[model samples]
Target: QFCVNYKNGGISYRSARDGFGFELDWTEFYTTTRKPSAGEVGALPVSGGVINGNLGIGTPNILGGSSIVLGDNDTGLKQNGDGLLDIYANGVQVFRFQNDTLESKKSINVTGRLTPTDYGNFDSRYVQDIRLGSLQYGQVWNGPGFSDTSGYVITGIINGNSDELIDGAHRRPIQKLIGNQWYNVVSI
Candidate 1:
């Protein structure tokens, strides 16, 4: 007969099979491996030990954090396999690593002013947008003013198919800023 004294956090336990009996309380849960004092939580310290599979925090529900960190200024943290690490502040993803390389998948979307002291590098998918009064580089890509129905589209010529120059009226698709690389722009 296993009786639980839930009022005072105690348990009355007995084995019905062999007439053998033993009482196990919440703290007694770890008494077999290590004796824990009254009102103390159990902790296991295993250094240089191997964890086989995925380790999870708040597996199903959301795990909250204030001042969360993955790799700090000091010695960094290491994650080997393809596991996702999400860092959230105020319930928003400030930094995330999902893909293979950390540098490739890592992204920072902060609100306030961010000033980097050292030189920073970005992926090749980034382009500079220069602006002058009513006109700007990459601004013409807006096609017609964006609404819920239509927006700008970037494309490259394929085989000898449909014309690639914004419906092919003004064939001047390539625009060069002085000696820089040509920018394929769509006209208004």
Candidate 2:
């Protein structure tokens, strides 16, 4: 049986087979898969703006805590275009993933920290690039497992006195640091 119920300010289908009809919204139309639960996907946001750019997709039902994450299990993070794919927080690009093999980019770029007065720009000094199969890193560039980070260009503050700088070959070492007492990072 076909049915139409004028409720919830706007009109919606109800009862017997609200006849599995189509819904018109804005410039698009959607067909119902089944009767929606009272609070299926939660209420729509009270307010928001239209998006006109790229975005990242994360694992379903997962909200980032201290750190935001993108991509998902059994998935491929792909962007097909002639532009850089970037992840930004607060209008600043914290990470950039790219497939450009040109001499300009060299490899992917990751921005961990920015200089105090250098917000909203890629300082390069504080950024880290993944650099897959880079020619400069030589054998370690996408080696059997992983190779030295020295080959790929990166910048970091190395404690000249306390902390040891293992491969100082490729890093643009900034020796301006306080007395040692530090944390460690594990990379693959």
Candidate 3:
């Protein structure tokens, strides 16, 4: 037998044979105008919503496996046994994380600045050419000047002395003439 009673601002249901009961709280339900808070236990908003807690999908034990899984169930982010995060695409592991290193199965294209915390090096066997907008020489070139009209070369001074071409510390100012006006290349 089954019974449903309206009480305590909610609908309480009970199964007589199983001796099990549950309550559907009215406060948990919300309309279009009423939205739940970030930490609230309620249905997510149709448009968008913020969750303040950890969300688990596909698995009840979120700590064991991937926290999220796409509709295909193959593409998702998972932490491996080594505690490194791995990114999967179409059931294939495309990217992975090692100790202080990021590994990718394909080529990486960066549009903006790629700054390294310390020193960075590239394999000469794989890297054929590297293009740069401007090249700055640490030491002054005492060799013959190139007559290449394709590129522009500007001569500058360090510490207001043209003879002191090299400034290891880069504490001096570097200036170049631009249409009769001198502009400081590096701010002091």
Q: RMSD per prediction, one decimal?
A: 20.7, 24.6, 16.0
Please report how far candidate 3 places residue 6 from its true position, in Å. 9.1
The lDDT leader among the candidates is 3
In model 3, what is the error at residue 50, expressed in angstroms?
A: 18
1-188: candidate 1 lDDT, tens digit per residue: 65566575555455444335544332233334354654354333344443444334323222322222323222222233347665544344444466653343345578999875533354223444432222222322324422321222333222234544332211113342332333444445
TM-score for all models, in order of appearance: 0.22, 0.16, 0.34
What's model 3's lDDT at 104?
A: 98
Worst 10 residues of 3 by lDDT: 123-132
**Best model number under TM-score:** 3
Candidate order (lDDT):
3, 1, 2
Model 3 global lDDT (CA atoms, 0 to 1): 0.51
Evaluate all candidate structures by whole-model CA lDDT and list the values in order: 0.38, 0.36, 0.51
lDDT for 159 in candidate 2 is: 35
Model 2 lDDT tens row, 71-179: 5422322233456454444333444566743223234456886336534354433534332232222222223323454323353332334545332223422222112
lDDT of 2: 0.36
Candidate 3: TM-score? 0.34
